[model samples]
Target chain A: MSSKKLFLIGLLVSFLVAGFFSFYSSSQPDGLQKATAEQGLDLTVVDSANADSSLANYGVAGIENERLSGFLGGAIGVAVVGIAGTGIYFWVRTPKSGETK
Target chain B: MHMPDGLINAQVSIGAAVIAAGAITVGLKKSKGTLDSQTAPLAGLVAVFIFAFQMMNFPVAAGTSGHLMGGALASILVGPYVAILVMTVVVSLQALVFADGGLSALGLNLLNMGIVSIVVSTILFAGLMKLLPKTRISIIGVSATVAFISVLASAGAFVFEYSLGGNATYNIASVLISVMSVHVLIGIGEAIITGLTIGAILATRADLVYGARKFLPAHNLLIKESVVA
Candidate 1:
């Protein structure tokens, strides 16, 4: 498959999963969170530094509609991770013997 | 598991981060061999896919849900070095952007999620892949099993860190039991996703998958032979 097609498919999957499907995700505390609460370890958790970020908790900060917030948040995450990660990979990646980034 | 801040003392968090940094540094150097222009996009896609899967958590037990960790999955899709790098990116984004994980605890989270999980999965998967048949079915089976154990290893790693630097005063014995039990169930879920996703990708694009790359040329000829027969 062409790289363009591959990337598009990946982007579509990301959008579908994070944007459309994320609404169905479990809202209950995850394994570690539940264990900490039950194990009397909840007291130790410090608030996250980016807890106030617009896209915190996989939802947009000011978005009134939960689904929309989640949709936008998921899209943003995919974009950020896709760009930042691939960017870093290219930057730090070993250049071919006679190539440049 | 994404360990939040305040769970462990700052010293331990920083220590784990330091270790994680060293591992990532090595991954950067080693992955360079595997990641040229051709494979770079695939590596990034692996991160995106894993992150999306993580967003959709399924219920594991009462009041506790588990998501796909993708350590074993990534290692199988990409090589271990690039897989480690992919996982680090995912976890870092989660902490820095999603606020899902603690910023201060990013080191421990990276250690558990990226370093420990990938290392364990890579070692286990490589060893098992050697013993298993080169057939795609066998590969998926081994990948699933190893991915399951890798998740448990990550859980164990968390327990180890908790013992070392946990702010909680709970008994170490109970903490071990508590973490391992739920994580086992979570590992089952991880295994299924890892298996299914790899299976799907292999079915359509075996040539693109790194773990299956060595076997692809022969597999392609075998397919032609079977078709002729």
Candidate 2:
């Protein structure tokens, strides 16, 4: 497949998957958190100084809808990672001025 | 595992970041020296495939879900040097773009998942392949087993890191056991997916597979013999 076609397909698939993940992600504790909770150590864990940041909780400020917050978070994630990743690949993979292709 | 911001201490995070940066620098130089025009595009495609597979999270015990790390898959399909570079790209993207992992903790995440898993898994897998028969099935089995073990090792690295910088006072043993056990099961799932994917690719385009070199001679011999007949 052409690079453009491949990229578009990847982007589309990423959007759908990210949407699904954002929608269906478990509210329950993950492994570390779960283990901490079970061991009664969760109480001692302190949030980072930046915990007050809007993105800290994967939600935008004043977003009352939890589902929307998650969707937005997931969408932003896809865009950010996808663009950044592609850019890095291009930058690193690009041949130098003197280098032959 | 994308450890969000504030999960690990800043010192640990920064330390890991330095290490991750070093690895990437080395990887970039190594890849530039060795990466052919042919292999570069394939590496990109493999990254996209990994990104796709990562989206498919299988059910872990109870309600938790786990996704493929693709460290072993990348390392096996590509060389270790390039594999680490590919994985670093994936992880860096995940952290910076999606905020899946914390920005500050990007270094640590790369160390844990990208470097440790890809580097260690590739080395172990290559070692095993030397001892085992170079058959397709054997390669798949070795890949799966190494992938599984590498995941467990990753979990151990997490536990060790946490012990040093952990905010919680949970028993180290319990945490280790829980994380290790869950990851082992998760690793099995990772193994199966990676094996099947690799097998499928090999069946179609064996030359595209970087790790299928040993089998290539035999396959070529068979093809030549058939053509002669």
Candidate 3:
């Protein structure tokens, strides 16, 4: 298949996974959090600097609907990373000189 | 794992930041090869996919959960250098925009989840691909195994970093043992997700997979040999 179709499929997968399947994700704390608790190192963890952001913890702050909040947050993440990553890569990318348009 | 602020002392955090900065600078140069017009969108989509997948946590052991670190998959799909850049973007976005990881601990987060994992998987995948038989099944097996071990390697790096400068005191050996135990389970999940992703990509567009590029020709050679025999 063409690279274009593959790219679109991958991006669509990202949106679906982030927007929908993410709601079913396990809410239990991740490995570091679990290990921190077990090792008593949880005390050292300070609140993230951006913790007050409306999208902190993947939930839109003050948004009553949990799934919608997570979906929006995840979608926003996809857009942010997609734009930032593509722009940086395309900027730094050396153009293959005069091969094609 | 996303290290939180104050979880690591300033000594290690800043030290890691310096290393990460140097690595990312070098990565920017090397990533040029991996990001021509054809693959540029692929790289971006991979980052978006990682960000999306990182949210889906799977139960590992007891109450602990693990999410897709994406280093193994990224480095295999893109080269390690570009994978580092992709991971840097992902982690930075998560910390800055989402507040998933603490700002102060960004360096360590980037190091463990991005650099170390990529390095380990690159080496392991390169080595295993050379040693294993040339077939799609064997290639996928090696990918899964290396992906699993890279998780442990990255986790071990965290344990080492913590021993050097963690604020809370604990027995180093004990810490290592417990961390490894839980993470091994997580590593299994990582392996499965990585293998499945790669398998799908291979079935659809093996040409786009950097790590499997070497193996594809090898597989063709094996088929040729069997046909001759």
Over B46-79, each residue of candidate 3 has an lDDT whose tens digit, in order, gives: 8899999999999887798999999999999888
**DockQ for each model:** 0.59, 0.24, 0.70
TM-scores of all candidate predictions against the true structure: 0.92, 0.77, 0.93
Worst 10 residues of 1 chain B by lDDT: B217-226
> Candidate 3's residue-wise lDDT over A11-85, tens digit each?
999999998899999989898888878888888778987889888887788889998998888888888888987
Rank ordering of all candidates by DockQ, starting from the highest: 3, 1, 2
User: What is the lDDT, from 0 to 100, of the residue A33 in candidate 1?
Assistant: 83
Total backbone clashes of candidate 2, pairs 3 or more residues apart or in separate chains: 3
Q: How good is model 2 by TM-score?
A: 0.77
Model 1 lDDT per residue over A12-96, tens place: 9877998889899998888888777778987978788778887789998888999899899999988888886676567444578
| Candidate 2 off by > 4 Å | A1-29, A40-101, B218-229
Residue pairs in candidate 1 whose N, alpha carbon or C atoms collide under 3 angstroms: none
Interface RMSDs of all predictions? 2.1, 4.0, 1.5
| Ten contiguous residues with the weakest lDDT in model 2 chain B | B33-42
Off by over 4 Å in 3: A92-101, B218-229
Q: Which of the predicted structures, 1 or 3, would earn the higher DockQ when compared with the native?
A: 3
